[model samples]
Target: MNSIDKELLIKMYMNMVKIRRFEEKANELFLNGEIPGFVHLYIGEEAIATGVMFNLNTDDYITSTHRGHGHTISKGAELKPMMAEIMGKKTGYCHGKGGSMHIADFKVGMLGANGVVGGGFAIATGAALAAKLRGSKQVAVCFFGDGASNRGTFHESLNMASAWRLPVIFVCENNQYASTTPYRTTTSVENIADRAIGYSIPGVVANGNDVFDVYEVAKAAVERAREGGGPTLIEAKTYRIKGHFVGDPEMYRTKEEVNEHFENDDPIKNFKSQVLRRGELTDEEMDDIDKRVADEIKEAVEYGRKSPYPEPEEIYDDLYV
Candidate 1:
């Protein structure tokens, strides 16, 4: 708990709960057809986003993946705009054009959530290079999946980032599957972090289900980057509790495996138990945070519902071509 302050610890708890509940709401809305398009719910990996993002500054940049609502929310994006974006409302972050896979808020240094696997690599690397050139302390974080690690973009980006000594961190959310194929079947390495050896940068691995574990590791990496120590590769071992996308048949895994993670490996529940056991936070405090987050999410969904959809004629707007 070297990096964990009481306030930040509590905030992390609140954020974890917020991400979990928000995804649950998104799932409900998608099932009801209130939200259009495919939604890959980030239900189980709440700790990874909350823990790693807990110490970031407003100037720090973060690139997100398709399962990115959690990252967007953790990076301090407004709930209303995010919900509206997912709902395809005109008031959305991208005027509803980007939808769930492409919500971005540059003011907060969130580059964007990309639908393409490994798409954020170049953007994050570029952001890091810009920061270094401008003599700024901003660090860039690229969040990709285990599947993305196998792509050429990952290798190309890492090679450049390492060579330049850019202030970037590559975070791989290894959920053990690339769509329908198991990660082990595709990736030759046992641990994704091991690949960092080729780049000659620090490679670290942490339990994604444990917020404190992630926080400790991320804090060190962030501090090192700010001190001009260059890039780090972090592989968070997490599990996706849902199908790759909403309405997926999910024949790749068994129900028992999913249920086991839900019951035994739930990060929120584990954090709550740890905090209560250590007297870090009282039950009343935890309940209060939960209530507040619930209310916030409730209002966000209502706002999205009441928000107007983009007019058909507005399609030509915000386009370069």
Candidate 2:
């Protein structure tokens, strides 16, 4: 933890807070009928995105999962554009076409959040290949969930990445559930990182709730990839505090089980505790960060609301190259 600078530590904390607040606000908007599509909230998994993405440069590429707001925010995407995209406004990243699961900012190297499970594996791999071909030191990161690890694309991507020594990092956000399915029931291995062994790549697991822990693991992996050391599969063992999607009946898990995670295993709470314990940030500073994040989200929502919708004919605009 001492290896990370104080400014970066605070930035990571602030980014986590931003992601939490943004997801909460998105949940509110969805329930209020302001947002049109289903939203997969990244409420409890903010630390994984914050920690991992903080290690990346703007030129580095990242492919996101369906629940990707945190990834986008952590990668330095603007909140107004993200909120606008969720609201299907013309000012969005995709001019209102790419909705909740598909917002992208190529300038910031966010390839796009995929609605399809395991969709980002190939994209990230291809980006890594391109970077290698271009003689660029850029690395590509693919963020996926436990469910995605079961997909065929995951194996294929890992094989190719390992064979070529591609500059890629495969981050498995093992939130313990694949939609409503518990990871234990569907996953054969005790940890998803174990699967990376088959491909002869380094596999590491980190306490996803602890930002420092995640940062430490990701920093090494990212550094390895940058140095042409090939891909690393990082299994971030965290919990998804929210339902699979907004308005989910959540009959798969018991109320008591959910309550326990919410009460004790919250990532943000754990992160704040770690920071405070280390005397890195005072309570007053944490409170200020929270306040600023709330204000930013408020402004983002307002900006989304005020933005115009695309014209009917505009749908065909970005269709061609």
Candidate 3:
């Protein structure tokens, strides 16, 4: 709060708020069968995406996880196409060919959300290597969960990145539970960031609920990547508010656990409080921004609902050169 400027602080708050509302609406639509395919909502983890995305340029690429709606929005992707994609409309980013997990906006530098665990680690590493070989200062941010940290691709990608000094930031969104199983059961290390030492890269951990904290850490990592320094691993400790996915039965954990994070450690609420406490924004102004973002999401859904579905013949449009 004290570290960020008023404009950026307000913007960070706005982005996190936008993602939260959008995902909430997504859950409602998905339950109603308006959206096709399952979506992994990034409800309580908005701060990590918003803060990390702020450090990137539109030209700097990022690869996302299945829970990628926040990444797309933070990367400046339009809401209509994203919703349209989820709804399986032709107007969507993937023209209805790819649903929630595969929707991408390379125009905005989102490489696409990966469905396979630990897949994007290698993809973003390759992108970074490409950029480095081409002598471009562009950096790549690879977003994955703590569960991926145990995957072989994660270690391989980091090893390659470090060996060649690739410009990439491996941002691990450690949201406590990895689909009902907590990290304590699966991961031995108390801190996921500690794994970076094996790769000989810098590592840091930040409170994922605090957008300001994430932004500061991500800024340093991005600067390091841009300056041709080797990769950095950032483990953002957060909480995922929703179930593993839509329609998940509460078999793994208790309601009390999820409710605690939603009510207490909610990232969006925390961001607004930090900004308002600093007197950077009045409640009235924040309300206005909230209204604006809500209206946008509303229109986005409307546009997707009214837009035409994909034509039968157009299925082969992007299939070949």
lDDT of 1: 0.93
Q: How should the candidates be ordered by lDDT, best one leading?
A: 2, 1, 3
Where does the lowest 10-residue lDDT sum fall in candidate 2? Answer: 1-10
> What is the TM-score of candidate 2?
0.99
Cα lDDT tens digits, model 2, 1-321, are 778887887798899899999999999999999999889999889889998998999999999999989999999999999999999999998899989999899999999999999999999999999999998999999999999999999999999999999999999999999999998998889899999999999999999988889999999999999999999999999998899999999999988998898888788889878878888888898899889988999999999999999999886897788
Displacement of residue 155 (Cα, Å) in model 3 is: 0.5
Residue range with the least summed lDDT across 10 consecutive positions in model 3 = 1-10
lDDT of 3: 0.91
Question: Model 2 clash tally?
Answer: 0
> How close to the true structure is residue 111 of candidate 1, measured as C-alpha lDDT?
95
lDDT of each: 0.93, 0.93, 0.91
Residue by residue across 131-250, what tens digits does model 1's lDDT show? 999999999999999999999999999999999999999999998889878999989899999999999999999999999998888988999888899999999999999999989899
Clashing pairs in 2: none
Off by over 4 Å in 3: 1-3
Model 2, runs deviating above 4 Å: none
lDDT of 3 by residue, 1-321 (tens): 455777887688789888988999999999998987888999899999999998899999999989899999999999999999989999999999988999799999999998887889999999999899999899999999999899999999999999999999999999987777888898989899999999999989999988888999999999999999979999999988888898888588889988987898988788667667767788998889899999999999999999899999997898888
